[model samples]
Target: MNLLKTLAAISSMTMLSRITGLLRDSLFARAFGASDYTDAFNIAFRLPNLLRRLFGEGAFSQAFVPILAEYKSQKGDAATRTLIDHVANTLVWATLATSVVGIIGAPIVLYVIASGLEGPAFDAGVVMTRLMFPYILCMSFVVLAGAVLNTWREFKIPAFTPVLWNLSSIFFSLFMVKYFDVPIYSMAVAVMVGGVLQVGIQIPALKRIGMLPRLSINPFAGLSDPGVRRILKKMGPAVFAVSAAQISLLINTNIASRLGAGSVSVLQYADRLMEFPTGMLGVALGTVLLPSLSKANADGDPAEYSALLDWGLRLTFLLALPAAVGLATLAEPLIATLFNYGAFNARAVTAATAPLMAYAAGLLGIILVKILAPAFYARQDIRTPVKIAVGVLIATQLMNLVFVPVLGVAGLALSIGLGACINASFLFTGLRRRAIYVPHAGWLAFFLKVVVAVALMGAVAWFSQAQLDWAALRAHPLLRAGALFLIIGASAAVYFAVLLALGFRPRHFMRRAK
Candidate 1:
């Protein structure tokens, strides 16, 4: 399997998902603007998503994929299918219980997440939280199916399924807002519908691979399966590792809520922009790398394992650095062009731009964490990342204390970015110290070439953006969007042109995986 080709395929699907997600956010911004209600909706939506990451994509995938890959490789078809059935059965019951508890405790959950909300905003949050709480149950099943598909190298289905959720949200945001007494409630409805659509799409793909899970009649039937027990044990530290990061986000949201109304929404807007590259590159690469890395580890091939990590890191610098530079240099134009309409005014654009730039400052670090953490995860060493994550959480909050007072909401973003850098550094060090990853030759040269190209790209972006009054062009959104795309295109051309001139090639980065 050509890993670069696979990365490109998955990234393209992710690109579609991110594009639709941005459109959804833009519509919501236009319809509702940055306000207390929008804050309520963003917070409510984030709660279930945070759990989905913790138990679905984040911890569960970390614990599940490596083991599932091991089963397919060594345990034969019958045993692997049995593991799948029991695991799915166990996860369904667990997430269903979690959803019920969350729905019943919606008020307390909202208060814990963002106590600063009051009046209608607080009430709306509770209602929306309850409405969307069951989203976790849907997504848990979706991600479990996705992990199986990825292990089978059926990447496209899992990668494309997110677009279903995005489309559902886009529909409701565009058409159904008017039906609600409180317009933002449409978004909550969208979340529930989207979850169903996302999970539903996975079934046909799973059946095609002959790995569709059969839920046991008794939910407890999976408890005695040795493979299920192994996964459950791994999940303990996996949950902690993922939870530490989620806890930091939870704290940041609470802090933002206290900062003022719309603060949570502002950070969320900037985060959506950040997610574009992070998802396209970080997520796409991580998704492909983990299963391959697990195979390498299962075969006890340290050399192949190290080579895979090297390819991911080198690719990270080549692409992520330019993206980070583009985001930082073009922050205002990007924000103003995409979001400077409806209730998202000039002030809102400016508010979001600062955090976007702050986020850009640590984009490389953030993407690197996505790459580095998986090395540990593939080796089934969740405890190391959990320890690092906990320490990073403490450090992030400490930085928040110093920066939030001076920088406000941007401080929260800045702290998160810097903490990601810290986390990635520690993971890299751990990899080296354990001799789990020995850097291949040419890294120093690779670093210099990417830096030079990124520097040239950043200059082009900065100069092009400065020539336009992005906010003033809000009246001509098409022209603004056209110019923004043109500038980005030109900047990308320059970055790649420089790389070509300096000896970088697609073939240089390509690698085969078993």
Candidate 2:
């Protein structure tokens, strides 16, 4: 397979998902604004998403994909299908039980996550949490199907599935708000509906690949399967690693809840902006690299494994640095153009800009973690990341103590960005010390070229943004959006144009996966 082309395809699909997601947030901000109710909804939505990452995407995918790839590479088709059946059956039961418990304990969970929420906001959170809790079960199935498809090199379906969810939210948010006593309750319904759609779309793709799992009648039936046991064993450390990160998020949400009514919503808006480059680059690359890395390890080809990691890291730097520079330099314009409408006013835009810029400061590090952690994961070594994550968690809270008071909500974002840098640093050092990855030649020159290009790009972005007051252009929403797009387009063109002049080429990034 042409890995660069595959990466581009996946990134393109991911870009669509991010675009729809931004539209969804834009509609949400216009309709709801940063208020007590929006805070309630954001916190409520995060509850199921947190668990979904833990049980479905985060820990589960990291642990499951490597093993699945090994099975596919070594055990042949029938045996691989059997492994899929057992793993799928076990996961279905586990997530079902978790969802039930979460639904019943919604109030308790909300309290633990955001104790400061009270009265209407607290009530809304409990209701929404309960309504959306089953989303965990739906996404678990979706992610299992997605991981299977990704291992088979069928990246488009999984990359595109998120768009369905975003579309669903947009539809519901636009049409269904009036049906509920609490308008935001419609979003919870959207979450549930979107989850179902996400799961539904993956089924035919799985069947076509002949990897559709035949779930057992008895949920407990798969516990004795050796593959399932192995997955469970690996999941021990994987769960801890994912939980450490989620714990930090939970802590941040709790802090934001206490800080003020709209603090959580403001931070969430900033995070949405940050996730654009992350989902497009970090997620797209990690999804592609893990299976290839695992296959290399399964075949005992260390050179191939190292080359894949080098390719991913280099690609990350080439793309992510320019994106970071754009985000930092164009924060106000981007935030204002996308979300500065209705309830999300000038103050909200201003409030979100600082955090977005702070997040931009560590964009490279955040994306690097996505690339580096998978190197360890593909080798079935989750404990190292778990240890590093624990220390980063502690370090993040320490920084929060120093930053939050001084910078308010932006401080929380800064701490998380710095923590990601620390986490990425440790992962990179671990890879080097263990001699698992050696830097390919031309890295220093490559670094210099990207830095120079990013400098030029940043200057263009800053100059363009300064030419107008994005906030005052709210009356001219279309014009505001057009100008922002033009600035971003021009900045990106200059960055790539500089790289081309300096000696970078698409062919240099093209690698074939064995």
Candidate 3:
């Protein structure tokens, strides 16, 4: 597979999903606004999301894909076919059992996740948890289907399905809220619908390629599949890294639970916004690069894998650096413009902005992992990144405890950044130690160039903030959004120009059209 083409396809779909997600967030902010209801819903939503990432996509895909790819490479045709069948059958059975346990244990989960609490907020978490529990099963299946698609070099469908998920959330936010009198729970219900649709829609595409899943109960039939065993071996450590990240989120939410109603919601809001750029550029690049890198690795083509790694890293930074600057600088305006309406009030917006800035400070670090972690996965060396992630996890908890007393929720966000920076350093250092991919000597210079560009961008944004009457803008939607857009677009233009002058070219990472 061509790395550039694959990245473009994944990026295109992820961009669409991000766009729709922004709209979904905008509507959520405007409608229910952020509150106890929002926090409960976010906590509920995050539970499944965290699990989906840990067990389904992040861990599962990282471990499963290379094995699947190796199967197709070595087993030729028939064995590869049987192997896929066995795994799918085993996965579905396991997922269904997990989902049932989750649904039954909904109260226990809510208590543990957000416990040492009571009242309406606790009630909401319980109610919404039950509402969204089915998403575990739904999303697990979607991830399995996505794994199959990615292994087959059919990434478009999997990537595009996220757009459906976003749109589903939007529809529920707009329509379903009123009927239930509580919009957030209705939004929770959208998870089940979205996940089902996401996976179900891919079946036809898989069938078109004659690679659709088949049901079977014969797990022992393929227990010796070298690829399956290979994947399982890698999965042990990948789960540590993925789970550590998820556990940190659970900690954040648990901390926020004690802080009052809207803390989690605000963090969630800022994070959703932060994830836009990260998803489009960082995760998309990783998803696309992994398979290509795996194929190159399988063929013993280090040169090709190295090139793909370089291109992927460059694109990640090119996007993340500017976004981090923009987010940190424009946090208040963004919060006000997008969320300060409806039930979401002034105090809530203020609380949300701090974490947004904190998260912004570490955006590149967090996303750098998205790029660098793939190198280990592609090379079938999950253990090293796992060790790095463990060290980062310990540091994250300590920092969170230390800072939150002094800095509040923002400190939690800041600790996340610190942890991510440490995590990336660990992983990248390990990669370098292994002589995997030594970044170009100009990496520091490239970083400094971005900082300089961002400094210029920040000046304009900051000056405009002083000049613009935020109160007046918040009072009106159209003018508020227009001004925000103008500032963002202009700053971006300036940054891009500076990068070009610094010899940073998009085409350096992107493929030239044939």
Candidate 4:
């Protein structure tokens, strides 16, 4: 596959999904704003979303993709097919059982997730958690199908599938909310519907590939299957590693839950804004890199593996830096443009802005972790990341302790950024010590070019902010969006112009098709 082309395709589709997600969030903010209703929704939403990460994308994909890639590269078609059947069966059964327990134990789970909560926030959480728990089961199937397709080099379908989620939520928020007495409850129902659609959309793709597995519910079956056993083994360490990172976010949310109204909602809005770039670039790179890296490892091509890692890292750094700078510089405008409407007042925008900037501070580091963590996972080495994650978790909590007392939600965002830096540093160090990856030549010069380019971009943004009358822009929705686009366009132009002037070219972003 042309790595650049594949990355572009996935990135484009992810960009679409992120755009839809932004729209969905804007509607959510307009309808609910940074109130207890929104806070409760966010806390409730985080449960299934967190599980989706831990089980579906995090541990399951990290563990399953490499093994499946290995099976495809090394084993015959029949063997690969059989392995998928067993793994799919096991994954489905486990998720279903977990969903049942989650529903039945929603109150206790809510308490655990939110710590000190009562009244409407606690009640909404319990209701929403039960409503959304089945999403995990649906998403387990979606992830399994996505992994199978990804291993087959069918990247576009899975990349496109998440758009269904954004679309579903957007539809409900716009149209169906009035049908329900409590509109937030409509959002919860939208989530469950979205999960079903997310799974359904992948079926045709799986069928076309002829890799769809027959449904199975035999719980003990995978225990006796070799491929399933191997996946479960890898998944064990992966679960712990991914869980550590996720737990840090959960800890942040739990703390924010106790910080009074709008705190959780503010953090979530900031997080969603940060996710725009991270999803488009970071997630796109990781998805495309994993199978390629796994294939390289299976074929015993360490040179190719290292080169791919180098290429992904360099490209990620180049893009992520400018993104971080832009996000940090434009946090308020972005928040105001996208979400400062309806019930989402200027005060809520102000509340969310600082945290957005704080999250932006670590955007590059967070994206690095996204690309770099997969490197270790692709190598079938899970222990290193787990150890690093544990350390980062502890450090994150410590930072939270020091910063939260002063900065509030922004402190939580800062802690996460610090943790990301720690995670990225450790992953890079581990890869270097093992000689798993080697940085390309001209590192000093490359860093110089990117830094200079981003500096210019930041200057453009800073100057624009000072000159523009944001209050006037905010009063007119269309004007706000237009001005935002103009500023962003100018920033991009200056950044790219500087890069080109410093000898960076379009081809620099692409690796040779290998």
Q: Which stretches of candidate 3 lie over 4 Å from their true place?
A: 181-183, 217-226, 440-445, 511-514
Cα misplacement distance, residue 35 of candidate 2 (Å): 0.5
Q: Candidate 2: TM-score?
A: 0.99
- Residue 129, candidate 2: Cα error in Å is 0.3
lDDT for each candidate structure:
0.92, 0.92, 0.80, 0.89
Candidate 1 C-alpha lDDT tens digits along 407-475: 999999999999989989999999999999999999898899889999999999999999999989989
Candidate 1: where are CA atoms >4 Å away?
none
lDDT of candidate 3 over 174-251, digit per residue (tens): 888888855568888887788878877988987887777687666455457676666667777898876666688789
lDDT of 2 by residue, 185-258 (tens): 99889989999999999999999999998998898988998888988998888877766556777799999998
lDDT of prediction 3? 0.80
Going through the candidates in the order shown, the clash numbers are: 0, 0, 0, 0
lDDT head-to-head 1 vs 3, winner: 1
Per-residue CA lDDT of candidate 4, range 213-320, in tens? 877656767678888888899898898787765788998888998888899999999998899999989999998899889988888899999999989988988999
TM-score of each: 0.99, 0.99, 0.94, 0.98
What is the lDDT for 50 in model 2? Answer: 91
